[model samples]
Target: MNSTRMRITTIAKKELVEFVRDWRTIVAILVIPVLMFPLLFILFPLLLEAEAQELDELIVDVELQADDLPDGFQSALEYSSINLTFAELDAVENLTEPGTAMEKLRSGEVDAVVRVRANNSTWQYAVLHMSTSEQSNEARSRVLLNLGEWEQNETRNRLVAVDLDPDATLNPLQWNGSIAQGDVASKGEQAGLALSLFIPLVLAVWTFSSAIQPSIDMTAGERERGTLEALLGLPCTRAELLFGKWLAVATITAAGVLLQIAGLTFAIGYLATSDIISAPTMTLGVVALLCVAVLLFAITVVAFELALAMRAHSVKEAGSVLGPAVLLILFPALFTQVINLDGIELFWFAIPVVNVLLALRELLLNRVVPVHVLVWMVSSAVYATLAALYAARQFNREDIVTTLS
Candidate 1:
């Protein structure tokens, strides 16, 4: 037993050395994670905010016949972000044709055309003809906001004239939404809600992507380089060889995931300091639980990757198989995030990948049922064991080791 343990440890150390030396593996395990999460989660938001501000600088041209507008409506439109102009003297005839306003919208001649007609003593019918272009949408939004304010002011004036309380008249229904904990969510809860949907999927994808090269290179890559025979001829058993390779893969994959988490945390802190976003609620306890979950997930992924790599005779062949496999795993992980977590059926915990994602979702939401943790850990361990055994059995075969087939 001591000799076997020593053999596995020796192999694992050697694999780790090789992993650290490979530039691609080093980048995947270190540099990419440090850059990717921050760029995606932090820089993207800043760029998007800048783009939105730029969109606000656009000047929209809108045509309106002010003569027929209500007393305060034209003034309200003038105060809006849009530039309102009087339609041509023959505008009525032109507007009657099909697609006339739409054609103008397409040609960028105008952003919107507004027509208003008194429908009743208390109501006015307004038609806003606009394209789906960004400028037109912004124009429409501005017009709507101004109209709503005008309507409120008009309602208040009418209420005052009738000697009635404007607030009472406008809002008879005192309905408001409140969370069970309070009227507003605490900062931690708010952060959890924002991140719960996305973080699990990101972690799962990173775990798979980070492990792919290491797992394949340890098996098929070595085979393609004609080094597998020498390694297999060592006195260690096939199970020890498989376990060591898998351990190296899992270590690299888990490190990649943790590095990404660090990046995400740093980005959150930077954004929060810049007042661009709130800090995420991943407390030390929460992070510890997350790391445990990620460890289990990485183990399963490593074993699965090793199994596929063992089947393939070359690095390219392993990649062809594992790429689709990663996609297959990603779809299910993402699917459970949008599903009703509160009402998740017990059977979901019995499944392999589904349970891990669901468990992550619950954890991010700051709750974890004991049964869920038990089921997730137990089932993942079983799958990892089975997969590892399958890969070891494949390694024990002379044909798989000796042939390109």
Candidate 2:
């Protein structure tokens, strides 16, 4: 037992050294995860916020005739943040056109056109026309909000004239919402719900991307370099050799994922400092669940990728096989993001990549059940072990070992 342990350790150390020496592997593992996290979590939101601010500051040019304007209408427009610049309706250059107001709007000379027309009775109608541009949408929303407020106030005044309480008629039902009075979600918990859908997909892709290159380089690259046969001839058994290579891959993948988690935490921290997003409450239990999921996922991916790599005749062929495999794993997680998680069946927990993603999502949302975690952990372990055994068996095959052309 001791000798076998020593043999595996020796092989693992050698694989680790070889992996570390390859600067390409080092850069892929370190740089990509670090860069991707900030780009997704930190920079993307900041850019969106900046664009939204710019949109908020837009000056909307509106066209309306002074004679058609209602009393106190301009005062109502003054209450909104959107800058509403009013111009005469006939100022439109195309005066002969039947749709002159629409012509000015379509020509981009005005953001929107507001017209109020009254029939023979007291009822009047207002029409707002604008294109579907971002500035136009902002102007429309602000105008609609002010119009809605005006409508409500007018209704309330008419109700008072009829000797009726506006509140009783307008809001017949009223209810206050609270988090069970005492049970409230922490900022971290709230952040988790917001991130629950996205984080799984990101981590899934990160795990697969981090594991594939090293796994291929270790298995198929060695075969291409004519060194795999030499290593197989060593005194260590095939299981030791396979385990060592898989361990090295898993180690590297887990390291990259850990760094990625740290990077994401830092990015979220930076965003939280702006008070735009709540800080995730990363409890020790949550961290443990995440760590375990990452470790299991890495092992499963490395073993499966190593198995695929072992079948390939060259590194290029291995990449061709594994690149699509990464997407295959990634798409399921993304699919989960779109679908309702509550609707997912228990059988999904038995599906390899899908299980871990769901489990992690549940953990992030602080709604994880112990049985689900157990099921996921057990299923993943079984799959990983089976994949590792298959890789070890492949290493022992005479055809695979002797196929060094």
- Name the top TM-score candidate: 1
CA lDDT scores, all candidates in order: 0.78, 0.78
| Model 1 regions lying over 4 Å from their true place | 1-3, 88-99, 120-132, 175-181, 271-287
**What would the TM-scores of all predictions be?**
0.87, 0.82
- Model 2 Cα lDDT, one tens digit per residue, 1-405: 699888878877888898889888788897778877788877898899899998877777655443455556667677546456665454433333336666766777766666554445343444455557776667777777787787777788879999999998989997667644555777777888888878898889988988888888888899999998888778888888888888788888888888888888888888888876787666788778877887888887888889899888889999999999978787898877775567567777778888889888888887767778888899989988888787777777777656675
Tell me the tens digit of each residue's lDDT in model 1 across 33-63: 8888789877898899899998888777887
Worst 10 residues of 2 by lDDT: 89-98
lDDT of 1: 0.78
Lowest lDDT block of 10, candidate 1: 89-98
